[model samples]
Target: MAKSLKSPPADLTRISTRNGGTFPLARISKVISGEAQLPGGHGNREMPVWGPFFSRVDADQDLGRMRVDSLARYLRKIQQP
Candidate 1:
């Protein structure tokens, strides 16, 4: 008897929850402008914030399609009341 081949499980992508688990768009801009603040009442100081920086792609760039329902659900989960 031949054994059946098993398929691998689907990959699960996770969102980062650092910095209060929120996307800091304003904070990022402030940091770029040299006016960012530290958390917990710490005095203002220069800190190196490193992350991926991508150039602006065309509006019609087609990497792939995202499920709107899934994205809406995720956004709803993270939204503050």
Candidate 2:
């Protein structure tokens, strides 16, 4: 996944991370739903706010093709406000 300097869509619910990473929750939902893909190969310079910087792919893979109904609630509990 090449990091996009381009702006993300307006309607997305984005979770901003350190080092210029913004993971749109809806887009990630799409990824998990098979409506999209988030392939590996982008480096650790940036990553979805979900996991440790070095292994974001593993985190994403763990959520693959599965619907996690409480993603926002889960993320909210774990992540800083």
Candidate 3:
């Protein structure tokens, strides 16, 4: 006889603020595929996801850190009041 696995309880901590007020799996898949707009009209199509990767590269010892430091310094200067 094959044993049946019981279904887990629904997670109550999840929340959403979009039109449906829930992050449906289908919508998340669409967003991942660059076919859906996020809340407030923002979408992944307009932004490149490279900041964290560059940060990691900046911290690597084998790569030159001077250019990364210079870019960081420039960004800090631009953000100064």
Output the number of the lDDT-best candidate: 2
Task: Give the Cα-based TM-score of candidate 3 against the true structure.
Answer: 0.27
The TM-score that candidate 2 achieves is 0.31
Instruction: Quote the lDDT for 69 in model 1.
Output: 29
**How well is each residue in 1-81 modelled by candidate 1, as lDDT tens digits?**
123313322111212244455545455444433445544325534343322121123343222112222343454355442
Deviating ranges (above 4 Å) for candidate 3: 1-22, 42-81
Give candidates' CA RMSD values in order: 14.5, 10.5, 18.1
Q: Per-residue lDDT tens digits of candidate 3, residues 1-81?
A: 113423332222332332245445554433333345643453223433333444466566434333344443443344312
List candidate 1 segments past 4 Å from native.
Answer: 1-16, 44-81
Judged by whole-model lDDT over C-alpha atoms, candidate 2 comes out at: 0.40
How far residue 7's Cα lies from its native spot in candidate 1, in Å, is 46
Q: Model 2, range 1-81, lDDT digits (tens) per residue?
A: 234634332222334443146545665554334344444423432324332322344567554333343453454345432
lDDT, candidate 3, at 2: 18
Where in model 2 is the C-alpha error above 4 Å? 1-15, 18-21, 41-67
Error of 2 at 5 (Å): 28
